[model samples]
Target: MKKRRRDLIQLSILVVLGAAVILSLVLPQLPGRGRELQPLELSVIFREADTALWSNTRLGMEQAAGDLGAELRFLTLTRTGDGAEQTELLRREADGGAGALVVVPADPENLKLQLSETVGSCPVVSIESPLEGAGLVVAPDNEALGRELAEAVLEDWRGGMVLLLDTAVGSTGVAARLDGAEAVLTAAGVPVFRQTAAPGRLAAGLRVLSSVQKAEAIMAFDPYATEQTIRAVEAGGLGQLVYGVGVSTYVVGALERGSAAAVAAWSDYAAGYLAAEGAIRLARGEAYTAEELPFTVVRGEDIYEADNQKLLFPVTS
Candidate 1:
């Protein structure tokens, strides 16, 4: 009887081994199991010529590309707000066999028009600006970001004129931010004046406007504008409390030095990482969903906090 029991145990072990081999073969064939995705070629186009503003974003993209086995080509316009140039670049990248296209649209309306005409088979993902019917969009809620900035100003604002500076005049994202800030300030019975400047002339414009308009506080709607506004304020000795949106190094430094009061910032690092990953998944025919990253209002005191530090300064390595 003992010999019979030993033989039965050996038979059971053999049966288990056979089942494992069958599973190993069949599992790979099943959906969502051990599938090797093809390496993808991704193209990213930014709306502006200054790639410096997108440094953290680029790092995030590079990290995702390395992790996901994808090749990335980064492109930017020769001038800010060059819709025609952006369209041409999009067409060239797609026709040159890019598996996916990611864009910070210089002109969202123009890009939406080009999407069907230019991109034949490749999927398109938009970052920082939303394109309706585009596969996915990864960005912060611009309106909310604006409201946050405005609220930061309202915290200590007793009363007086507040200037809403619009450096990127045509950007829907920037416009949304301006609108949000306006809504909040207007609802609070604050007098707000909307201001606009030509690209590359915001500093000069601010210098001229501040000399005449007499705003008690200045709120810039984008990163470049915010940086320029802060510099203009300090250089002119305008004494207007500066508040804006963005988290660039200069903006952070200004906040630390108390030249700028506060900034509404989101993680551009997360934005870049999500855009690349979303494009790859769309290229691979996998499921992808639009992502809206959150924002934070960083003041002088909040800059060094652990959570805010990560939001403001992402570790590239």
Candidate 2:
């Protein structure tokens, strides 16, 4: 009888132990007991100063940071395309304990080297342009953007001289765009003349070029260049149809005014969101598949269409 009683007690204890073990495994995943993740500090470094051009992108990033329970800091270079400045900022952020970083590299080659030495184990994501060593790159296919802009120009093109405005002349992004544009225009047998200049001075260069060479159509590779072309065309009374990439108030206004022919733009907002999300994922050691960013060509006639408006103007509230 005593032996049987002891065995019964032992079995009762074993059953209780099993039940406790099962509860331990299940309780953490229960509705009210889910694990809480601490917010991470993320830093975003831009190649240039903050401007209206970045508003939509910034909004998207801010929203993502909020949604993902992360802190975000935005830093920009005082001078555009200052690779050294960008590199220094990267070092500073990493040393300052930034959980992750998103960069728009001003000089990819130099930054690529710097990133290897400076960032240690922190994850990095790049946007706008490519940095070879970044953990991820979130940007539209720049070459495709250029091709679409070229096609837009050819829609009404009767073929004369088409001027290719090379804004930010030496950038990898711009170079890719130029390649795509040139390929399309050359294949069509359109006479293409190229002009290279910095963003702020592109309009002046355009005016000077127009004085000596008459072109039937102008293709600007970036927002500032496109806006400058519109201003140069309108203020100088030069009658050249303009097409380009990017969206800003100036570019959109030009489109509405019919001074600009067409603009190729992607959801910069989406680019921003993806960059933030990627940084967080990489930081957490989570696996991520890069999302493809698609582009759209907006013309004056369809600028107000719901889809285009959603891209150009997002409801950040």
Candidate 3:
């Protein structure tokens, strides 16, 4: 009888130990399995000091951030066309623990090192102009844009003098477009002249116009430059010039006024939307690739068309 009692006690102890082991394993998955993820905060910095270009990009980013339930901090460098100042602002944002960064570097090449440093701990996406070492770049294919502009000019004007107006020499977008224009113009046996505008000088347009000996077409690379060129051309009695092309709202307005032959524009809203989406994906440990937004050509006659208008500003369209 005592032996039987001893066996029962041994069985009871084994059952208790087994129950304890099972409880330890099951308790961990009960109501607390993994650590909760912290809410993400994203920062977007615009290179342009003025908020003129910020409108569409801001609208897209705000909408995307809202839909994704993420916090967004909008920061501006407050100076137009200053690369150094923009880089400083990016460093500050990154040091402050922003989970992701979206930047439009004023100078892509000069700002690459600084941008890479800032983006080391977080994802960095670029709009309009791309920098090296960026997580994702969102812009139009500038070479394609340039080629299209050149083709348009060549088709309309037959082998007459043509001048190309570029804002800066070192910009990737400007260089790409310039190369494309050069290739097309050369292939068509069209004589081409190239000129550079001073940084932030509207009077450069007047200077360029004065220097042109005889040109049937003037291709302005930027929208504001195109507008200034139109004013200068009109002032100099060169309104008879066949074609003017550029990129900008002012240029679009010039097209509306019959001053421009064609304008190439990528959806600023789509750029912003892509940047925001890229940031969110990075924050969530997801993968994304560099994206090139499509471009649209706005002609003088189609400037007011609904489809063209949609390309000008993407958010509302």
> How do the residues 167-252 of candidate 1 rate in per-residue lDDT, one tens digit apiece?
66557888899999999999999998887775566666567764335788888887777887888888877788998887788888
Question: How does candidate 3 fare on TM-score?
Answer: 0.77
Which wins on TM-score, candidate 2 or candidate 3? Answer: 2
Could you report the Cα RMSD, in angstroms, for every candidate shown?
6.9, 7.0, 8.1
lDDT of 3 by residue, 117-236 (tens): 665767788776667877788878888888988888876886577877776454676667778988899888898888776435643445455446577787765444555676676666
- Candidate with maximal lDDT: 1
Q: Look at candidate 2 and give me any clashing residue pairs.
A: none
TM-score of every model? Answer: 0.85, 0.83, 0.77
For model 2, how big is the CA root-mean-square deviation?
7.0
What's the residue-level lDDT of 100 in candidate 2? 95
In model 2, which regions exceed 4 Å deviation? 1-38, 203-205, 210-213
lDDT of each structure? 0.84, 0.82, 0.71
* lDDT by residue (tens digit), candidate 2, 65-172: 988888999898887667788889998999999999998777788878878888879999988777777889887788988888888877889968898877664357
